[model samples]
Target: MKNKTVAAWLAFVGGPLGLHRFYLHGMGDTLGWALPIPTALGLYGIQRVQQFGQDDQLSWVLIPLLGFTIAACALVAILYGLRQPQQWNARFNPQASADAPAGLTNWFTITAIAAALMVGAAVLMASLAYSFQHYFEYQIELAREISQ
Candidate 1:
């Protein structure tokens, strides 16, 4: 049976890598397989930033993919953590009894929820800020050129 605490922590820490998805959904999950694409692109974006610097347009677009993916996973984790034992069992462990210990929320789950919230919010905000800042700066440059 899938354990709630483990799933929550996995989603918070390894969500970008799709570890939590794999744990809950198994290897055949297509979306689980797809999770790494944005993560890789984001990593590549970081590499681009390091190599070409932050002014690189492609990196500006790519970096946020990673952040958004991470934030999404964190959101997923929060959702999992908040689920009632009955609901969690009904969904993820249908074969098990309604009161299965696997579905119970505990300190670990709460910690995972708190951590996911903190990190996800920060990453999401940072991504939005980065994208907007670059986009507006680019627009400003274009305006200046036109005004010249």
Candidate 2:
């Protein structure tokens, strides 16, 4: 397959897994994938604690199910990328060598832009999660009242 075909497939299938990072041979890119592992575990733990306290043992079943589903998806992405690295290299300019910017200002601009985007995304997700949790508690309370 052409490099572009492989790259497209990787983006389609391996995006969430950081497979693209592994494909680029940049382990640092795996940070996006690695960071989520703990988040997944924490989510499951929270769900488990909530279910147990509510005496709804069945909800715990979803913990393992959701965990396995996410893990499977990530694994599939990683495997697909590893299997198609040749395509990835071809699709992207793998030959380009990284060189320091000739000017200090150029380097600063690039770094600043990248950092700003990352921070923005992180803040957005954190706010969304906080809101979701708050609303979820309200939903649970409403359900309890209706049932009572």
Candidate 3:
């Protein structure tokens, strides 16, 4: 059975790759296998953009997809951390004795939760800022054209 702390840490550290899902649910989890696809595309897109230029339009799509994936992973980590020990144990380690130690409140779990929240919030804010900037720039261009 997978330990909750280990699963939480894996989710926080490598959720984009579905590492936590794989750890808890095994390799059969398609979502876990699929989660890394966007990350890989995003990384390749980033390299291409850096080597060539922003003209690599694919990067525009890949980067945001990757960002969303990361934010989703962070959310998973937070949810895992916040899950009650009893529920987690019941779901993942039902065969284990009730007296078995549930590692929910450990330092590592706490750190993972905090890190996930911070990273998720930062990514969300950055995405919002980028959207607003582009929207305002378009508005400014429209206004200038109307004034002319």
**Which candidate number would show the highest lDDT if scored against the true structure?**
1
Tens digit of per-residue lDDT, candidate 3, span 3-39: 7778877887898899998999999999999999988
- lDDT of candidate 1 over 1-148, digit per residue (tens): 9999999999999999989989999999888899999999999999999999878999999999999999999999999999999999999999999999999999999999999999999999999999999999999999999999
| Clashing residue pairs in candidate 2 (N, C-alpha, C atoms within 3 angstroms) | 3-91
| Rank by TM-score (best first) | 1, 3, 2
What is the C-alpha lDDT profile of model 2 across 39-107, one tens digit per residue? 465466557667576344443433443344344444433333343334344444445322212111233
**Stretches of model 1 off by over 4 angstroms after superposition:** none
Question: Which segments of candidate 2 are over 4 A away from where they belong?
Answer: 30-39, 42-91, 94-148
Residue 79 lDDT in candidate 2: 39
Please count the clashing residue pairs in each candidate, in the order shown.
Answer: 0, 1, 0
* Selected candidate, larger lDDT, 1 vs 2: 1
lDDT score of model 3? 0.79
Ranking by lDDT: 1, 3, 2
